[model samples]
Target: MTKKQEYTGDYPEKTLYLPGPTEVREDVIEAMAEPMFGHRMDRMTDLYTTIVEDTKDFLDTDQEVIVLTASGTEFWEATTLNLVEDRMLVPTSGAFSERQANVAERLGKTVDRIEYDWGQAVKPDDIRDALEASDEGYDAVGMVMNETSTGVRNPVEEIGDLLGDYPDTYFVVDAISCLGGDYVDIEDHNIDCIFTSTQKAFAMPPGLAVCTVSDDAYEREVEKGDSSWYGGFRRTLDYYDRKGQTHSTPAIPIMLAYRKQMKHMLEEGHDARDERHREMAEYTRDWAREHFDLYPEGGYESQTVTCVENTRGIDVAETVETVSEEYDFVFSSGYGDIGEESFRIGHMGEHTVESVRELTDAIEDVAGL
Candidate 1:
């Protein structure tokens, strides 16, 4: 006789208020349930073209768009692999930004960095100083538009304006946490390459990494033969131009979800979406200040996530666990060393100010503050 195993097929439903992999829309999830199709078929081309064109229109940029079945980290390596010829200048302000510099070094590229204290935004003047001081000059400058760890939004536009003088040096931005929600003018800022993950602000399930590549970046890669054969900007863009589909197999199910979600995003329009994120940030910041304090510098807090300082000396992990157990809601503690001293509340994606209030109210109830 076989022994019966105990099983409880039930899982606790949590409304994610964490940084990445935030709450996914029900319809978006269902979209992935769509029937499978052949990747080489015309139908795949239609799906690929629709999402690519829609993303370009949504971002209001004429640059090439590449959607790969990978995380935003893939672009970090791809950009380093393809564009950087000699040395790359990276600004280190937080965990993710520092990791970008580290990735470049691991790829055997010379990495020059302008370091800042964690929670502080990268100073554009400091970047200009680094560029001015570098006698040999750098091939590219990498930065994070939003530092997810400490919840600081760097002045990418100001840094981009500074880069305009150094035309030979390309500018790359990691907009993983901010793209769809923050409303950056990529073309106007002269940003050569910027990438994001769908799980962050696109309000979709994870798997796809979307990137915008400028003509300058493409041309530079073309000059360097055999650069990043797999994820190269020119190769991907060329394949899309020829067949209107990805060079490699893509996550078709996720693309179906992306098609559906991007339609909703385009309908909402960039102005409205950006305004919504701004409102959520303002509301979250106001709430944090009321209960505790913001971890990031003044006037530079992230529009997507708010890292609240433990001014009242509350147990952050315990408070988070209690709130989750009581209310079936979840947010994040700070990243790395600051995890115990600070907590994070994500306000991006499809989250509304009303939804954020629900989590805040639950936290207050649990913390008794």
Candidate 2:
């Protein structure tokens, strides 16, 4: 029989510089310790409504918001199930975007892809060509706003605008790693559904997924008539309209943290947050270019995470381990196929340029750059 490890309440505290599960504020952490409340209670109403409305205000959109106790990946499935009745189009540039296409196919929907290299951006022209080439009308089009794997930020807004030509096709975007920090104009882009989790740029602990749904997407699900039970827009939104809470039991503690953290987001303001992220991206890219090369194509790099190509050919995993062990700083190695060729630094959440420099400085010391 295998022996169980002993329980220890203590763990080392390391500053996170990874794409997701970024550093959450201490106050936000404490907010999770609030007294428990029943999902049907009035307190639950206050908690749910405040977070939902605050998210809309933060995103500056009138579209309905759904907050569920799941990762941002939930929406990949939800969006596919809710909107795509048969055929959908996906433009794959990196790992996450490919997974979005895979989700649709796994759900038994026909998915057509306009494939691009991992580090490349999804071109609007390519998406336009794909849509025009399709003989059967697509029920939806999906793509990632930020490809976390390669630090590539695709022009989802431009793609969303292109999707405007096909009003019958719902446009779904996975903005998981950049939504709160990147500040997309959801309504203006004509996006049918866009989603993110609190773990990324929201600067909160992981547990919740949030998304905004256009009326068209919701009605389309109604027309399809076989929507998901837990993630259905009609079920959750209608429940909120009638009772001001989630249809199923929710993670109340995380919602408390969300309420607290959302206030911080609002005070930062969407535009200000966007500017902060831009500044971090600029700084990180400059640093990467100085010491290494960038992975993504120029002019389309992500604002939240920067993937630095290992131009100097240093041992990435070794440096990451040394940084964690010696400096107590945690960044990420490149994801998937590019793991050894690149490294990534997440500069979103509450991280400033000055804070990001600390990690770079540590890297320079350990990697002897």
Candidate 3:
């Protein structure tokens, strides 16, 4: 008789409390262990090809989604090279978005930046004003949906509406850290381009980057007269066109795992997943506010993760290490220069309310807060 592979809590697992690679469900992990299929085979095309199509339905878009064997950063180059000709009017509220502008500048494109104070959102009015003020009407405008740096969720829907009639400008979003937990109405919102990585909220291991491009953007890529082939939109488009295949042997396990993850996300329902994320965020934020200041403003906070200000003066690194070594629960120190004064805790993916409660309990016990 074959033994069933099941995991019990007799031995605690390494529960991730930081952002990016959150905790995936047991079923999803098993799904990833499926035998590898040939990338050149029809079976591969059928399985992953469906994932690409289903992802479009999930996003409520008629746009063609190009799955790349790269991170979301590649789309920065793809978007800039394809749609952008001259200058980019980029607005940033955190580190990641700032890097997008930097990518534009590095590519020799003139970049006009609209930067906001850290821990704040890029407001719709700011976008509207910037678009109106641009004498050249900007080649494109890009922003991040959820800034992982400070746990601030940007108001993307509002900003999208602000750029409604600007047919000449491309509205691109870096939706990496918020895809599964965050609900984005792509078509109704009139988003020109939406890019996301698989690791964060998709409940899959990293290696794939997804982008949904509008008909306008597709035409632009097609008309760009061969800017780039490798890691470019042309290669992705051609792979789908010629053989219904990916550019390379994909992270086969991750692709298979995504099938299960997507099924679970859909079976459990998008509304439920989104509500749970919001619930967890609210609970964590309420607790954090009572204990320390929120990194972002009170009204504007992230639903997938929370960045908490350290008011109790506990050594964050010491506390994190102590808790991790003691209980096997890992958390995040503040990023970049703010590592000492801040910390982050992710509450997305397969984690339940009970799980979050356990995480909170561990923090309270270890730090005596």
Those runs of model 1 whose alpha carbons end farther than 4 Å from true positions after fitting are 1-9
Per-residue lDDT for 239-311 in model 1, tens only? 9999999988899999999999999999999999999999999999999999899999999999998999889
Question: In candidate 2, how many Å is residue 233 off?
Answer: 0.6
For each candidate, give its TM-score against the true structure.
Answer: 0.97, 0.98, 0.93
C-alpha-based local distance difference test score of model 1: 0.93
Best by lDDT: 2
Count of steric clashes across candidates, in order? 0, 0, 0
Candidate 3: TM-score? 0.93
Error of 2 at 166 (Å): 0.4
How far is 98's C-alpha from truth in model 3 (Å)?
Answer: 1.3
Question: Which candidate should be chosen as best, given TM-score against the real structure?
Answer: 2
Q: Candidate 3: deviation at residue 360, Å?
A: 1.2
lDDT of each: 0.93, 0.94, 0.83
Residue pairs with clashing backbones, model 2:
none
Q: Give the clashing residue pairs of candidate 1, or none.
A: none
Off by over 4 Å in 2: 1-7
Candidate 1 residue 340 Cα shift, in angstroms, is 1.0
Expressed as tens digits, the lDDT of each residue in 1-369 for candidate 3 is 999978765866688877878887788788877766788989988887888877876766788888777888888888888888887888887888899899988888998888887788878887888888877788788888888888999888988887777877888888888888888888777788898888788777788888988888778767766555655666777778787788877777888877778787777777788888888898999889888888986677998889998888889999899889898999898878778788899888777778888888898999988
